[model samples]
Target: MPSPRNWREIPARYRLEAARCRGCGKVVYPARRACPACRGQEFEKTMLSWKGKVVTSTVVQVAPTEFQMEAPYAVAIVETPEGARLMTQVVDCDPGAVQPGMEVALVFRLIRREGHGGILCYGFKAVPAA
Candidate 1:
């Protein structure tokens, strides 16, 4: 529908990094700028696989003013291999078909167009794995 992949898109630099607390086992996605569990500032950049299962999901039947046309889209919280859970949209499959525990793969995708004069946001979306 839009350009294949917009760079200015959201997460233009969605590097899959996680912060596993050196003080604790709790991990943060996007690699917390700082550890929330122990307030520990030290962290190692760990790459996480996009592969995961749908932990939870909801299909929007009526989009919001910010996402009007996107209504009826399936959104989910995916649990990654690194154990970090992330909230995102489920694409490439029927929204009605989305369900918990469904295997999914992450992909960079366009999310929304800013009103009138703004950048086209893009980010990762999970889809049924082929």
Candidate 2:
């Protein structure tokens, strides 16, 4: 059986489902409900590269009630060479020093609590690329 963390991010981790617009060839993250580029309804599922560059970022000082203890986490909008952008949290670094255009590699991380059974909800997070 897959761990609770792996079960939740199955689409991203296993299938890597994303949308590639049939009209404009723009890759949309998470296989959007609608294409943002050409506003077309037609799409083809595509997988994303595990590498990307930070476009912009910020450190969240105030987190949600569930994530209150995880405050000061770093988040960023990253652009991949395949023309897809991802909004993900940056890890393995000083949250205060995250910068635009920094190269990052994809990694699965514990995002939050899942249940009373010590379950960890995992999702993709970015770390500095070596």
lDDT (C-alpha) at residue 17 in model 2: 64
Identify the candidate with maximal lDDT. Answer: 2
Query: Across residues 1-130, which tens digit of lDDT does each residue of candidate 1 receive?
Result: 3444444322423766566877776677866557777888877666678789999999988877877777779999999877888888887789989999999999877767755776676668898998
Worst window of 10 by summed lDDT in candidate 2: 1-10
TM-score for each model? 0.78, 0.84
Over 1-130, each residue of candidate 2 has an lDDT whose tens digit, in order, gives 3466466557865445678999999998877667887888899878888889999999999988767887889999988888888898898899988899899998877777755675666678899999
Backbone clashes in model 1:
3
Q: Residue 5 error for model 1, in Å?
A: 20
Assess the local accuracy of residue 70 in candidate 1 as a C-alpha lDDT between 0 and 100.
71
Q: How does candidate 1 fare on TM-score?
A: 0.78
Q: Assess the local accuracy of residue 126 in candidate 2 as a C-alpha lDDT between 0 and 100.
A: 92
Deviation in Å, model 2, residue 18 alpha carbon = 0.9
Per-residue lDDT value at 70 in model 2: 73
